[model samples]
Target: MSKTPKYFIVEAGALPEIFLKVAEAKRMLETGEVDTVHLATKRAGISRSAFYKYKDAVRPFNDMLQGRIVTFQILLKDEPGVLSSVLNIFARSGGNILTINQAIPANGCAAVTIGAETSGLEVSMEELLSRALSVEGVVRCEILAG
Candidate 1:
């Protein structure tokens, strides 16, 4: 039977140059900087055989969080344009809204749950929430689940 795969978070300086080159080639492919693996490997200064050998094994740390969908729950005052303002914060920061659900207004407040693909967020989650809370009529904001 094959052994289970184990992962390690090693520093870049300690890894071999080949591993780094493989990762760089992957990045170039992902970012559309190179149209083909041949070009990517050429630009990364590694042979195609070397890249193919280790391509599946190397990746950048931030890549692990790239496709994550975060759910945010915000409490806002029930007023015209209040919800739009909160959404504007996400729009400005490159957070893509996948889903939004709002409970009926009660006691002059509304509860909103927003699911956003935050991979492209220009600001950290905490900073995004802080900006949301700063908007007028927003009462409470927190990450419910991601």
Candidate 2:
């Protein structure tokens, strides 16, 4: 009988060099940088056997997030255009806005939650969150769900 595969999110620095090279080979092929697996493996400095062994198992973090819906909860100062500024960040990042909820301001701050489709996003979730936090009047942001 075959065993089911289990996965873990290890930091890039901790991964074996061969695994990283395999992932790079895959990227090269996907991006049309190389026309064939042999070329990709050669460019990435990995043997064809190693590339084939790990290519299916390794993927970039953003590629994993593609096609998923992500929700974020944000705290913002109740100032003019703060919400607009937040939405603009998502738009600029290629996130497809799905829904937005905002509570009435209480004590000079408001809570907002945004849901966005990430399939077409130009940036990763971490980058999106960073951009949101950097917006003027944004107090804090966190992933509510995904």
**How high is the CA lDDT of each candidate model?**
0.89, 0.89
lDDT of 2 by residue, 8-32 (tens): 7777899999888888888889989
Off by over 4 Å in 2: 103-111, 124-126, 139-144
Worst 10 residues of 1 by lDDT: 58-67
Q: Model 1 off-target regions past 4 Å?
A: 1-66
What TM-score number comes out for model 1?
A: 0.56
Q: What would the per-residue lDDT of candidate 1 be over residues 32-110, giving only the tens digit for each residue?
A: 9988999999998999999999998897754654569888899999999999999999999889999999999999999
Structure candidate 1, residue pairs in collision: none
Give lDDT for model 1: 0.89
Instruction: Tell me the number of clashing residue pairs for each predicted model.
Output: 0, 0
The CA root-mean-square deviation of candidate 2, after full C-alpha superposition on the true structure, stands at 2.8
